[model samples]
Target: MKTNHPGPLVGILSARKADGSIAGNGPLFIALQKKLISLDGKSFVFIPEDAGIDHIMGYTFLPEQNHWKKEKFRYPDIVYNRVPFRKSEQSEQCQQFFTILNEKNIPYFNPCFIDKFELYELFKRHSFLKTFLPETILIEGKKDLFLFQKEHKSIYLKPTQSSKGKGILRLRLTDAAELQLDGIHQHELFKSFDHFWEKYGVELLTKNYLAQVEIKSAKYKGNRFDFRILAHGEDKGYTVTGVGIRQSQTQDITTHIPSGGRLLPYEILQTNEHDNFIEAIVPEIGMALSDRYGYFGEFSIDAGVSMTGHHYIYEVNSKPMRFDEEEIEEKKMEQLCRIFLQLSDYEN
Candidate 1:
């Protein structure tokens, strides 16, 4: 289990061969490398340096037809596990590299512990969260989707491993010929299950998708309000750093920032009386998760509220977006750095 990499190092693993967030989306991954470089100690980023690495060594692997043919690295201190991730498909190369890390016992910021569906399994166990969680069924085709929709009327289709509203669709019925989707509006209204199966059969077949009955989300401007709860692992526990609401702008079903949503102050999330309700509830949920989900202290849980005033957890992110100041603040970065050090010691 020994190699030549130095102690307390950070390796930002990339799951994807090419990503749009090579710079903007990889702050913590980049910050860990920068912190290493500033120290008079040996440090290097293991990806492409121009990908916004300030002081760390950057490494790269050549790709041929979406395959990592050749890779170069001297080894790393700790890995941030910042791999570009696609939930539905696992690349053989990514699987191999992950195996290598596992065999090596390298510390990872967010260890490969859980996936989206497993998180749902965890969510269903929460007494308070279970009711708000829509009746969900993993479906292979429109028959399954149609059965759920026939009863629920409105259903949300999500990829097994998705982020930022990509491949998320809300289906509704109308008297027309195609199905009406969330962001796309009332464009297609599927008249029969066969029609839907013919159009989106491949997506339903190959992709691991789940269908959940839609919740009438807590509304702001008749759209929806969702809380992006940011928490981090520290000695005290998984602490709720901040809770911001992502209110969908217009013509969007989700409140994800990349999908035409804007962040609002926490207070804007509730009325004067309900603000205290929110404050009280968030801490309780945070405490429960910290106790149960061993090692995952830092994350963001996307929560939605229904018209009936119930809060539903949409998704929980193990490796969340770093704060705007994480790059500049040394003390906070040090705390996060410590978490990486502790979690990386997986063998212990």
Candidate 2:
């Protein structure tokens, strides 16, 4: 791979609120840019444009009004392309620029275009992903639910396009997982199908739905503990960067940080009994996804292990979270930035 003497031009693509505050993914966006800047004196430069299409490379403005231009124009020798996870409100008009960069042959993190269903299907069809993937049934309508229930006892209903684990619920004939109905949270149990549907029927009516067969996760304090394993890849394979466990508040069904859950380091989880298992298994989980799905670099893999010593890969991220644990330092960020510049040369 050719070396980018000075790093490539870079850009941060993110949504800012109507009041002009950076939106959800903005902090990490800026952090990456700063890291690139520090790594190569003036090598990486973030193109300033609409949130619609962002490339961490060279860009020139078309002289449009309200541009609020922050810097001079530069063409991208390479692009970082940390585009937002979801096409967002601020990015609604910024779509075409990403394509422009791709057409011009600037190597971006992920290709400019991806069918949203493409990765999901790859994950589902791959043999390795089968174990950790709960029985996922595409819910077309009410009939899909009926057919699934006939074959399985419990299924989790989740939105395909939702993030931060939103609009997710567990459906089963049990008193275990409780939720709110009419704004009331209770330990309500469902005795039969009729009883279950009566409460959540309206939510099911919404169009896009995904049903996953339920699997028992390792529980702590009656809640669940799952690892968000962060990784980055090159042509070689997916490499485990760090593994952090998410512990939910007592009795909470989901283990999302924003949903009253907290992140725990690996030390808290191993506790002697599982040391050998962690040493043996955690490093290898990402290999399956990379081998099957062709994921190149920078992924956050969500995985889990039960107290019974079973390991499963729940999901893979093409774009991972900002894993800046305290142990991770400025020098490491520089290393990652340097690596990205190198990846661009090889990919190009």
| Number of the predicted model whose lDDT against the real structure is largest | 1
Q: Provide the lDDT at 84 for model 1.
A: 46
* Residue-wise C-alpha lDDT for candidate 1, range 1-348, written one tens digit per residue: 333444444556553345433322444444555555454222233433322212333542222232222334454555555444543125565555556655776544554434556667666887765654667887866667777888887788887776767788888776664567654343565667677777777886577788877888878867777877666666655555666778888655777777777777766555654454445545555555555653454566777777887666677776575543332234546656666556544222
Q: Which residue runs of candidate 1 sit more than 4 Å off their true CA positions?
A: 1-7, 15-30, 35-43, 47-75, 87-89, 99-104, 113-115, 125-132, 175-179, 184-186, 270-297, 322-335, 341-348
Model 1, total clashes: 24
TM-score of predicted model 2? 0.73
Please give, for residues 65-109, the per-residue lDDT of candidate 2 as tens digits.
412235443445554545444554225344556557657765555
Q: What is the C-alpha lDDT of each candidate?
A: 0.59, 0.54
* Candidate 1 worst ten-residue window by lDDT: 60-69
